[model samples]
Target: MPTTLPVGDVTSNGRTWRQSYAEDFTKPAALGTVASVYPGMGLYDGFQDTSGLGTYAPAKVLSVADGNLDFDFHSEDGRPLVAAVMPDGYAPHTTARVSIRYKTTVTDGYKFVGMLWPSSDEWNDGEIDWPESLTLGASPRPASAIPGTYANRHVKYDRSVQVHAKTDTTEYHVATTEWDTGIVRFYWDGELVSCTTEAVPTKPMRVTLQGETWTDHGAVPTDASGTVSVDWISIWN
Candidate 1:
């Protein structure tokens, strides 16, 4: 159930937005338990290995021993990655904001935490891919690729914006996206990074969190592997 309790607030332009959804990740059982995810959240398990192994099992709930849980994403034989999604979903044209507190130790793979419409495949949908990093080309690339950077029918007229995090992702930080009807703003630690109105998504999108190895995206897999820990996710409107 969505609770009405106060979690946090974000103020912009003299208006304060109160949190509407909060996932504090408090798993009470053992680690790696295959239990239901946080309220209003959906889990996406990846491809099953044909060698008698189960489906992609990169996601797990790790007890912080402090009465809280951390969603951990690690590599498994360099195959399918894992992700968590918002089941109810959010839409454009609403004065809303979603924020995630997370950190990653993936130095040579991909990690993303934001809100988008894509699930297991390409929907060509617009995305607020904040606080994301991918190491593909000769260097690392931030998720805020130029709007219309993707080639697909759905993105032909897409308009979006993003910014690189100046802080190391190994440390916890808050990444947020504030969206209205015409503009979407990306923020890091309450600091504005990018704001644009181009190709902003018109469809409802789910909050998405993912961690994967390079091989999952057709790139060669290195020995590199790590976890992306999400402390909490909150929304305001």
Candidate 2:
């Protein structure tokens, strides 16, 4: 089944997250079974990868080889995760509900974080900073293991809840972002996890995936053995 990557009418300083991605890059270029590059092995051509990105870096692929799409995130500078673009020209002020059966992990002595961006470039581009990210599964406030923040002025959506990733274990879960007229709501597996309904962006935007190794305010790593994956990604009205 061909997945439809979704985008929205949101922008940031005329430079949404899509500034790095290009057009016709979201749909799966390679389908069915594929191989993946591994560390210590370094781009093995015969390791039986799930799927390969048409090009590496700056772009990641969602392979169904494992009954899910794997966005092989690496420890690269600048481009942490894949920030691809979707179709533009969303009806002005139209509400868009973006959902995906996606999950992430930060297992190998690092921090794990994901993102949802929106933009208006026909080149299928965009990236919006989260006003904030709320933590559900196994994190707490005042001292979060899986911390969520922003680079620009955007803040983390969900801060603290009860969602915690077991050290060295892969967690398969679902996350969603409800974006519409000036407000965005985030949910986890059909549950209302968190929501931001104020000070929404007045422009269009695109979808983005970002994960990295971050410190917990000079504290112990909640999830150190960093590695996260998403089974699938989809969007709807």
Candidate 3:
């Protein structure tokens, strides 16, 4: 049930964007959280495995590159990339619009997969798994396709990931999503790429980024220290 509420620019409840939504990453808290980290200079936090939620797993740190404090995660200790949703809480019957900017460096199948996983689990904060709305997608056959059971399925949220291949040093680009009930829409560089309404997730969620090994692309995240980096991330409720 997509609500008729109005949404705003930056951050909003439906019609208005919240000021905090467009916040710039700064010192200290800028790094977000690291599981086992070491803060230095512009990077305030370090990978502190024992530190818990606020910290990401796999002794990683937020480093500055290309005039931005981007996060580089490519290690066994590095936890699954995830973001936190403020206590403000998202509204019901409204759409959750999220946008993110990042760059990847890959070489093979290490599928550069980014998602909105529940920070609690990815960061080892709690036992609850992050609800997959746009990440999971819907589970019904599309009307446009021939009406019949087929091994090939059509999901409401058919999301595709981007890769920044190891050492490619190219800005894979930013993307946005609109989660409305059973539907999940995707946009890259402000252009709509997909619109799905399949296995829709209904719950509070967070942002996530990942680059795991994959054979489909015949690439894998090199076993290096820094393989992927993130420039900026935000969500418009």
lDDT of 1: 0.52
RMSD to native, candidate 2:
11.8
How does residue 107 of candidate 3 score in lDDT?
31
- The TM-scores, one per candidate, come to 0.69, 0.46, 0.49
Error of 1 at 68 (Å): 5.9
The clash numbers for all candidates, in the given order, read 3, 51, 55
Q: What is the lDDT of residue 2 in candidate 2?
A: 22
- For candidate 2, write residues 3-90 as lDDT tens digits: 3334443342232322221122333333222222211111112121112211233234324334444544443333223222222222
CA shift at 191, candidate 2, in angstroms?
1.4
**Cα error, candidate 3, residue 56 (Å):** 6.9
Model 1 pairs in collision:
158-199, 159-198, 159-199
Against the reference, the lDDT scores of all candidates come to 0.52, 0.35, 0.36
Between the candidate structures 1 and 2, which one is better when assessed by TM-score? 1
**Best model number under lDDT:** 1
Residue range 32-147, candidate 1, lDDT tens digits: 45244333455555554322222345345233433334444344565434444453343222456777776666445444445554433345545656655663111112242233
Q: Which one wins by lDDT: 1 or 3?
A: 1
TM-score of model 2 vs. true structure: 0.46
Q: How many Å off is the CA of 21 in candidate 1?
A: 0.4
- Candidate 1 lDDT at 194 equals 65
